[model samples]
Target: MNLEEYIKENTATFDAFLQDFLSINLTNHSAKLLEAMNYSLLNGGKRIRPLLVMAFAQNLDIKKEYYMNVALAVEFVHTYSLIHDDIMDDDDFRRGQLATHKKFDIPTAMLAGNSLLTWAFQILSDESTHPNTEVRNYLTGFLSSSSGHTGLAYGQSLDLEYQFGNKNADYKKILKMHDLKTARLFKFCTRAPFVLCNPKILLNNKKTEHLDIFGTNFGLIFQATDDLLDYRDLDKSVDLGNIMSYKNNDEVVNYCKKLAKEALASLKNLEIDSQVLTELIQFIIIRKS
Candidate 1:
């Protein structure tokens, strides 16, 4: 299948898998929290992180049901970030629908986000996620560190700092924030599969290092393009993160192209097929929503 078709088919399959995996019952006392969590998780998204997980796994020739645990874990963390981010950014809409905080109460949204974040580790800790206990432990620790205080959370802290005018939006600080807030998770997406499968060639520090580089640059490209789109569809109240605030529209676009080139170069160094990943770069640059 072509890249677009491949994405669509895989996305459909993943969504179905995610729905069944959640399998929440509404009769419980915490039903509202469950509903809010489900709403945020199943809400419209590009599913780019999970797609990366699946694509890398497939390219490694290690496709298996356990890989879905990795994919879902990544997405759960991502979704949790978005829900909490919306509340912090005071965004009323998410994916063209009401934000979780708006649809549910702020406390409910907060709990939902917390649950999703914790749920990611819970999923990874399950023996079903990996037969090897060491592998499961590694996955859990990797995910936690990536999304924890030194990673995505740290990035968001930087973003909020800049947003409230507490810090100047210099190019260096902006880039650092982008790396933390956005690219760190992408790093997880790219590196997790190799670590998951424990493939010899990919498992080496040097090779997985390149994958981490690719994921970071790829995520920067995604974030840069998103900034461009935000400029196109500028909302007066919402901050466009730091990129737009630091660089002009044309400069941001050029930086995106540069990041794509760097990311593709990293992919070229890897043993996997990169056709879909290359197309994904183009897709990110051209996507409207």
Candidate 2:
């Protein structure tokens, strides 16, 4: 299948959805900060986290609108993290645009980052965002915990330590840092819809645990692919972890693609609409960035 075609199609639709959602012009104190927050959030990326949310929700039989708020909110959290990350790492570019801190200022970026963080939860908690309280509650809690200290924040700590630590760090330890810093939220993005839509299906409902396993495995594979992408840049600027001395990104990416295939293999037995998601897994594995 043409995985690039699949992702390009879906991302077009998803980007439009994000624009429409942002049209709401929702606000809180610190209007300028909120504007900066919107600037970064709307600034482009692969939109992988949000896409995973939508893709998995579709598998669960939920449509685009049903998951739009959750997906958009997920993107918000992601953009906020990237903003502060660029500031902390002192990197100057993101997705080929000026890093948030540089585009604005350090303090402004910090407030803007905080602005997006709160807004993400606001979208989840907004009564109008979801049709049912149960779904809303599950999403709110899941996203919160994942982006909180237990996941993204702690991961950031690990990443900072590694930047100053060693380029040739143990592979296993590097994996841990990537997981907390990069994978945890990815884990959240892929699993949230399934869990929110049907916790029982995952936890105790014997009806379909395979999908849960599929999502978890899929998450791991996606995380690895992301790490591989960062390492692809020989300069290692986009990459947080110190990688092998340059020139082996091809081997690394191929290995990651293999892992992705294994993850998709786990879904072969699940009963769900996986047409796009199946393609998505492969697309992520092979994507350039």
Candidate 3:
């Protein structure tokens, strides 16, 4: 199957998994909270993060069922970040729907986000994710580090500081913020599949490091693509003027293409077939939303 078809198929499967996994056992007091969590979690998006997990799993010839929980955990973490992000950004809309904080109350939205974040670790720690205690421990640690203060949280703080506090933020600072806030999760998505593979493969530091490089470049491309789209959509709040002044849209597009190529190149030395990954990189650059 082609990349679009592959993504569509996997996205549907992941959506089904999320629906079943997120099914709320309602209590009278918590029904609204559950609704708020489900409202944002079930909301539509590209599902790129989970797709990356699945795609890399496929690259390693791992069974889809084996990685479903892993993929779900990634999605939950992503969703939780979005929930909190909306509140911090005070964005009224998410995926063209009311932001969780707006749809519910701020307290409810915060709780929902907190629940999702905590549940992501729960999923990762469960035997369903991986029977190996070592693997589970590693996954838990990796997710925590990537999503915690050193990773996404740090990046978000930098983003806020850059936008609101530092009028003189340079391209390097912005790129570093994007790396932490966005790329770290993408790094996890790409690298986690290797961790889920056989223990022998997991021990191969060189191979894992190669995958990390691939993920890092891919994450950069994803963010740059977003910046390009925001510019196209005339979202002036992004404060890309300094960056854009140095590099126009065409230049940014070329940079993303370069990063995509480098990402694919990182996989070339490995034995795995990376055609799907190549297509995914292309799709990231070309996708409109």
Candidate 4:
């Protein structure tokens, strides 16, 4: 199948799975909170993280039941981050509609995000996620490190600091922020399959090291393209760790190209069919949204 066809089919399948898994029939005092959670969780997204999970696991002998929960778990944390991020950034819109905080109240949105965040761990801990307790525990710990203070959280703290404070961050610091904020989760997405399928490949194994490099570069490319797309609306006077702040559109595109090359290079020696992932890197560079 072609790239577009692959994306469409996989996205639809994953959406269905997510809908089935999160089916809610509540009418209590917390109904609104659940409503808000569903609103943002089911909100239209590219499902790129989930796609990464499936893509990496494709052609492998592992069952969907083994790795599918990893896909859902990533979206849970990702959606939670978006809801909270919209609040922190004070943005009024997400995916061309009212952000959660705007549709509901800040408290409701905050609670919804928290609920999703915890739900990710809860679902991953279930026996259905993985029969082996060790794999389930590994997935949980990995996600925590990816989304917690030393990763995305610390990156957001730096974002707020640089956006509002007097300190000036150089390009290196900005890149580090990108690694922590964006690349860490991408790393988790790409690495989860190996953890689920082959328990012997530890985090420091060569296979995982290459996967980490690919994920980190792919994430940097993804962020650069996002910055390129959103550069128009940003205040030119402020530097928000966006590569666009330091480079023009053409330059940012070139940077994405460079990162894409590194990402592809990281996959060259891996003994798996990375064709879809290779195409995905190109797709990310050119995507308008």
Q: TM-score of the candidate numbered 2? A: 0.84
For each predicted model, how many residue pairs clash, with residues at least 3 apart or on different chains? Answer: 0, 0, 0, 0
Runs in model 4 lying further than 4 Å from the true structure: 24-30, 233-241
lDDT of 4 at 104: 98
lDDT of 1 by residue, 70-150 (tens): 999999999999999999989999988999999998999999999999999998999878888888888888899999898
Candidate 2 positional error at 81, Å = 0.7
The sequence of per-residue lDDT tens digits that candidate 3 reaches over residues 5-51 is 89889999999888777663324435888888788878896889999
Worst 10 residues of 4 by lDDT: 21-30
TM-score against native, each model: 0.93, 0.84, 0.93, 0.94
Model 1 alpha-carbon miss at residue 151, Å: 0.5
Please give the lDDT score at residue 189 for candidate 3: 90
lDDT of 1: 0.85
| Poorly placed runs, candidate 3 (over 4 Å) | 24-30, 235-246
Ranking by lDDT: 4, 1, 3, 2
* lDDT values for all models: 0.85, 0.71, 0.82, 0.85
Model 1, C-alpha of 97: deviation from truth (Å) = 1.2
Q: Which tens-of-lDDT digit does each residue in 1-289 have in candidate 4?
A: 9999999999998998888777742344358998998899878988999999999988566789777888998998999999999999999999999999999999999999999999999888989888899989999999999999978888777766665643577677778888888889999988889888877778557878888888888888887787777776777776665666678888888888888887787788566666789999899999978
